[model samples]
Target chain A: MKLSKSEVEHVAKLARLELSAEEADRLTTHLNGIMAHFEKLQQLDTEGVAPTSHVIPMQNVFREDVTGPCLTAEEALANAPESSDGYFVVPQIVEV
Target chain B: MTEYEPVIGIEVHAELLTNSKMFCSCPVEFGGEPNTRTCPVCLGLPGSLPVPNRRAIEFVIRASLALNCEVKEYSDFYRKNYFYPDLPKNYQISQYDNPIGRNGWIDITVDGTVKRIGIRRVHIEEDAGKLIHASVGNESLVDYNRGGLALMEIVTEADIRSAEEAREYLVNLRAILTYIGVTNGKMEEGTLRCEPNISVRPKGTEKFGTKTELKNLNSFRAVYRGVEYEVKRQVEALQSGGRIIQETRRWDDDRGITIAMRTKEMEQEYRYFPDPDLVPMNFSAGLIEEQRSLLPELPQARKERFMKEFDLSAADAEMLTSTRAMADYYEEAVGAYPDYKGISNWIMGDFTRMLNSAGIEIDASKVKPVDLAGLLKMIADNVISGKMAKTVFEEMFNTGASPKEIVKSRGMVQVSSETELYPIIDQVISENPRIVQDFLGGKEKSFGFLVGQIMKYTQGRGNPQAVNQLLRKRLSETKG
Candidate 1:
């Protein structure tokens, strides 16, 4: 299944990525090339093959709900592009 | 013109009461310096892998079982990809195709009729960071303190027919969650949230009209109002040949209207895919059974048992069992004193009043259940009159002192003995000669006046029963 140019554009829009026309065309071609390889695999189908989302053959990997140490606010905000009053500041997203 | 019925379903997102974040070990609590509760995994730092929280999953199972949902044997976690400032990860770990629980049902009562709401799914997800819009600048502050906390979303089928029914469902859902100790269920604290998506259909039509989801319904009253107003708006739109657009609307509480949220918000498309870092949850029958075993007596069962065991009215039993702590308090007090009616009366009356006026919950009150029962015992033992118990109760509530101490310190023992009350009754009879003559002259209400005088002279410490009897005898002797 080849991805159309518009589909790539839609994906880029949803991901908040600005793609120029050249970048969009390149993505569409690269995405279809990637999909063409998957198309080759669709030719061979084992009817009884079970669907699996995990390849590790594992389940129920969990951690006990015991609290450990947390990062200090200064350390947590050190990597932010902009910080103010111990908060990560972003452009206003909410209209109201 | 045909009548249309409003079709509504509610979604409740409750933060699980846990000690740590969903995927990390940061403490899960409210009101901390912003971002102090962050860890690499919760903040979605590169190279940090996510692990499931065992207790959080168990909490969801307990709540699902309480709602009568079937626990699935296996469920997978998905990454819901979206670009929002509040979500540091840009993709929230949630459940999509398979959730922890499914097909549960809960019963809510409205207009004296019990209605069952279908539980569509109960899935565990991580909470997003809180966004505080700045008042002075065109910027918003992000607090990751609430980020990655374990949250469960309980979605219901479109079974609610009216606003009142929707309100009842929310009330019942909150009670169940709080009773099971899964969540604090405080809407004002933002630990619990309710959203209802509403639509209307023609009376005989099988198809549903378009729906608009409502947000910012912070309280039960707001839920009711938002649903009521949305239903009206949809009906008006249909009547005027206007089509309802499927969008998300924000409830403007001050203006009491549901305004469509910005169109950008309407572009929310969560591309869901199973997350590779976390493994799928596989619940053994043994685990499910164990969770079911740990399910405490829910509100409905406790309410019924309270009515039967304590011989309380249904209303009183329901009130007592409204919250687990309050019900437990009542049971503990009853255990100490065993006067069911007396304890019930005090808790429902003055005790509840004190708790409300003090702006605290029953568990936070200074008055212990045993102490309250002790006060009731004092009234029963004739150590104090019912009138005097009020003053003693206030002291007990304020100081956390025993009833005996408060009564003794105040020297407010009841004058129950006839010998002690007789002199006071005689003094009242002689001092109130006009009331006596008024009584003898067939003005029987004047007897109540004489009794009031005696009670006043005793400083309201007169045992009502003994005072009534002794005063009657004293008036009979005076007539002779």
Candidate 2:
């Protein structure tokens, strides 16, 4: 149930978050506290309880395969931080 | 060097042939102006929710049923979090714990042995956008038009042991998917993509070695070559006392090698959780039955039926039933003319050659079933010789003209009557007295030369059978 500093750093890296040493150490303690609380909760006898992914009981919520309106290229790229030739520009990606 | 056994399994991702995107109403098309097919939901704009496409789900079910997968009654979508430029949402909605179908199997014939490869699971997911990198610099462009498109991932058990088996597995899988009308199954267009995880082990070892994944394999040939290269690389590494590392490798098709992309530690841990926006799917018995009924006869079954009913060889049956449209064309032509082998020959020979050369489907061609049947009937009734039929077919293919019309207009009718060919035969004999003397002097080739001359004199419209008979009679009468 203990959350280590390296685990926090790894998680941050996966989320594309750049965390300093101080922040990583602080988050480790904070996350460990949260994990301890969850561990305490896990100790209760709830073996028969059904696992629920969502609180809502909705099932088979689907839309028909009919196309509606779509955004123009200008509108789609309007909010992009950087765009060129109707495309969102990013730094060169070395790996896929 | 010790012999090693390689274990290979493939993961195929196919885009569903739906009218709209997976979670939005944007049209799901292959190519257009970049970013034009985007909507708020697909672009991952703030506060937008995703709604599943019904047809896409049905397509997954149909594919699962066709592959002999047990369709699950309950399935839910999960969000797999990752960071990539193509994934605008920073996550992909996919199935994790409960996929739509599981425990399926597909049978592929490798080296004349039927091997049943187990299907682990078939899940539905959304495709990310495409990234186009600039040729010379560290700059890339993203197009979200393909974002949020419906994709079905089919995972197979590690049953394949060779590159040829992997290729056969993909071929059969593509045929089945195309037959069910779920996906177009065009690998070249990037609709169907395959990745194989391969590992090598000592010949008698029961445990698997560290496996490396081959990615971005676009064609069956690429899959075959990629697996072959990876297996050999792994085997060589083991032989040199080098440890194998689990990693992701890209198939350098031009260079024909598997280049290391990233190590296992650098791989994303796709922290998956249930997406709160979309609800779970619960299939009713009626619904599953309806979807099952919608499944047409798949490729394997149709091939067997063709062999049984038409009395075709395995190769002929397989070639004729390669595609659904081709199979239907064959059936329709056979219905019109009851000569199974003749129809099979024409379809498998000239028909397929023309299709491959023109890069078109059978339905897209000008040659209709009736036209083909007419051509075959002409050949059967001796109205035109087989050699002449080839020319007539080309004319019909180019002009869309009927076989009868082409024959009549081009004066391609065979001269079969004895009364008509007798004088021509007599003239040929008199004109080619030297050849006649050569024939009388027991030169066997002179007969063929005279027949050629007679055919040339008749403008290639002579009935070869009658010409052969009459020429023999005339030569013998002169000899007597």
Candidate 3:
């Protein structure tokens, strides 16, 4: 069930992770351990048992069509790490 | 062509409409400042334990019952461990082994037929924050505004046959969620999301094939296109003797393609385990029944009623009942008129056109149900001709003015009295003797020209029905 170092590296690349060698090795073991748990699912007596997807016995939940409060410009910009006036400020990408 | 079959399943994540966050009292409004709505519970601060939102639980249960799902009286929460900046808690608190509902079926309309989509489970969970990828020096920013939002994951069995069917099922599910008032079902706002499981097998094959989970399809069109792209891609791969790999695909709405995002992970990917902080849920039988009774008339029943009572065609019924507000408006208009065909024409023709133009929904219209009723009544009682009603309708929509008041103020009322209409009719016959010759020469459409002339003389206020009667009677004797 263990993923090779190359496979671990490949997965990290796909996920766009900047993993160190140690982290890569650690994730290899973690991914393999996770795959092993799924392997146990193969042994369940699921031959005729249907796979369960939802747990609630309810349906047709709806709301009245109405508009609620929208965010104010001040409230919308409150949490930005950087902001100016009433908008979220980010580093400029285009050169003048 | 080797017989190929399509296996389809739907996963719907519905945001529970609550006044506050799932585990905190912070306002659960969308698009607030990144951290303005956050509290210790939603921010995942140390020593903050989440108390379940009772209303959220009830809403989920109500939704479950509406879908004919069996409610689990006792359920527990689990921790899905993952590492994402948007997820304040590295591990999300979700239901694993004991979800609140399971084994349900939802019927959706497809091509004038009802197709039942089996639901697998509906479980309560918390939503993560938003990650905005900025075009910066290679880093993305995380906004915690959406953290700790209540969400229910509705899983459906692979009972769908086509991408169109899958889209219909998703739309029906959204409609149900909105109708129950559980979620707003605003895909653009990310209140409701649909992830499709698609696979293709040899035709008539009983065994299932490898399925890929496609995500990021935020719109109905995207859901259909994503499933179609994946199905064709898988079928082509299998036909070429290439193995189908299980993976997670991201749907590109612009490109209209499904791109492989990452390899599909098994259950251990998140390292799920029961959370030690939260208590297990225990509900009484009465609570479940109460929640079930809270459900309103669902779309299927409403559609059937529209066909039976309103005598609407299948297509018109489908269009009208797609949303609750539209359907409600249609009924209110009908209640005012009691003339099914006339009301349908007004709603489907002018009402829809105005709504589309103003970018407003029926519920949000300034003109209320009584306003629509007033306009239709003016036409029904012949206080105003059908042609004059159009002008009054524009005034009603523009100023929220009642049809009666507008007609009285602008002197737009039709000449319904025979005494009032006969003078206009006599003036028209004497002015246009040649046009009457066309009517006598078997030119039936030319009668409309005479009506137009009569209407012009009355400044478009002539009672059309009276004018028609008078024109036919006087012209019958002048047939030289």
Candidate 4:
């Protein structure tokens, strides 16, 4: 499927990124190449054939029901851009 | 409008119970400080190389065999390129071309009917860091404490017909996973997650309609309700001649609605390619059989055994075997005392009721298996009447004392000897002359009152069965 220039811009906007014109152009060519590869898969007959999504066959993957450790307040906030008493601080969220 | 058929698929992410991260020796513990559990390997730092955890791969084989999936002799992991703060490497090391398992089915019971849901594949992958939205002005902060944990993505074919079937599928899947000791299957902590790709068509058409994926459903109830709401939303859109857009939606559990998050990204957009950093993997037959041997008796088999060996009803067996802990408790109790029916009654009746009321688990209770068995044995031996047995059991739960000790300390033994109760009975007969006359005058019910009086005089320790028989015999002899 060929994506118009406008569609590429729309998708970038929805993803919350400010892409420059040159970046959008580069992404368009790269995405187009990727979509071209999928065109090969579409050519294969799949009338009743199931779509191959995963390679390994597994069922009932489970874990034991037990609780372990959690991160401490200091460690959780260590990488915060900003912080306050035992919490990650950020810019004020609201205005009256 | 043309008729359409709904097609559904499920993608489940289950966290494996490995002691360490997939590629690093860092401990795989939940709820750690940001970046504390991280090392050079997990952070995708320069000079880091990935090493496979043999235990994790073995567990994958065990799970694959349980699901009846075929294991590829040669398989490998690939890089799924993406950019997000949660994903520090901007790409996830996932299985792209070949996964660990493929083509399996799980049997689930939906509304008293058994249905098989096809599993597409189960592949190994790394988990992303949790993003905590601090709701700061115009932006949300992110936390990387949980980044790079090991997880398996189990995707299912679009074969589910209803939300009820989806719930059953999850339950059965969780049970099997728990039985195999792979993932903890804990939804509260995000150990097991279900993302359902749901679409609705007219009741009988063959073509699938456009579907939306619902995410962030943490519980089974949320999944069912979310799917139901999505179905209704799609159905109404089709009826109104509006197109159903392909998108990803967030499940609002508080409001019970599936809100669209963003437009669904097509597979082509991710630009998936084989990871060049890792080599293709292979497994021998010996590896697969090794995992198979470690398997324990699963819930279905245990349920059948409960019915045949313990004579438990289907409902009782299902309740007892709900978890490994509860099943083990029941087995231990039965092992101590071979009275299967007696243990079942105590477990299903008072023990379960007490556990529920006290808001504690069976394993956490002060009562032990041997103590309960001993209590039941006392009742079975007629040393304590059933009524007195209940009292002793409660005291046993509170004090952790043996039932024999309680009975001995409280003088609760039933007075079964006739000589032991003869004096009390004679006094009751002489004092209650009017009642005795009424019994002889064809008022046979008065004999019951006489027996009660005798029991009261003996402080309820009189043998109830013997007292009834002696009272009836004495009253009949005086009738002449």
lDDT digits (tens) for residues B1-480 of candidate 1: 768999998889999999998999999877868888998888889999988889999999999999999888999999999888889989999999999999999987777787899999999999999999888878899999999999999999988899999988988888899999999999878899999989999987879889889999888899999999999999998898889999889998899999987766536789899998888889999999999999899998998899999999988998898889999999999999999999998899988998888878999998999998899899888889888999998898899999998888888988889789988988888888888998988999998998898889999999999999988887888889
lDDT of 3 at B114: 76
State the lDDT of candidate 2 residue by residue for B235-338, as single tens digits. Answer: 99999999888889999999999999855345768999999988889998788889999988889999999999999998888878878999999999989988
Question: lDDT tens digits, residues B43-103, model 3?
Answer: 6767988777788888889988888899977787888877666776778999988888999
lDDT of 4 by residue, B1-480 (tens): 655455679999988898877766677777645556666566676677866666777778788878878887767778886666666677888887789999998876666677778988988888887655554454434555556667888888899988888877787777778878898887767999999999987777777888888898898898888888888788878888898988889889999887776442333356677665566666878777887788788777887899998998888887787666678888999899988888888988988898879867687888888889998888778787777888998998788899999999998898878788877888899999999999888887898899889889877777788889887777777775
lDDT of 2 at B390: 94
What residue runs in model 1 are displaced by over 4 Å at the alpha carbon?
B252-256
lDDT of the candidates, in the order given: 0.90, 0.91, 0.79, 0.77
CAPRI-style class, candidate 3: incorrect
Candidate 4, residue A84: Cα displacement in angstroms equals 5.4
Q: Residue A43 error for model 3, in Å?
A: 22
Q: What TM-score fits each model?
A: 0.95, 0.96, 0.80, 0.76
Question: Which should have the higher TM-score, number 3 or number 4?
Answer: 3
Top TM-score model: 2
Q: Chain B TM-score of model 3, please?
A: 0.90
Clashes of 1: 0
* Candidate 3 or 1, higher DockQ: 1
Pick out the ten consecutive residues of candidate 4 chain B with the lowest summed lDDT. Answer: B262-271
Two-way lDDT contest, 1 vs 3, winner: 1
Native RMSD of candidate 1 (Å): 1.9
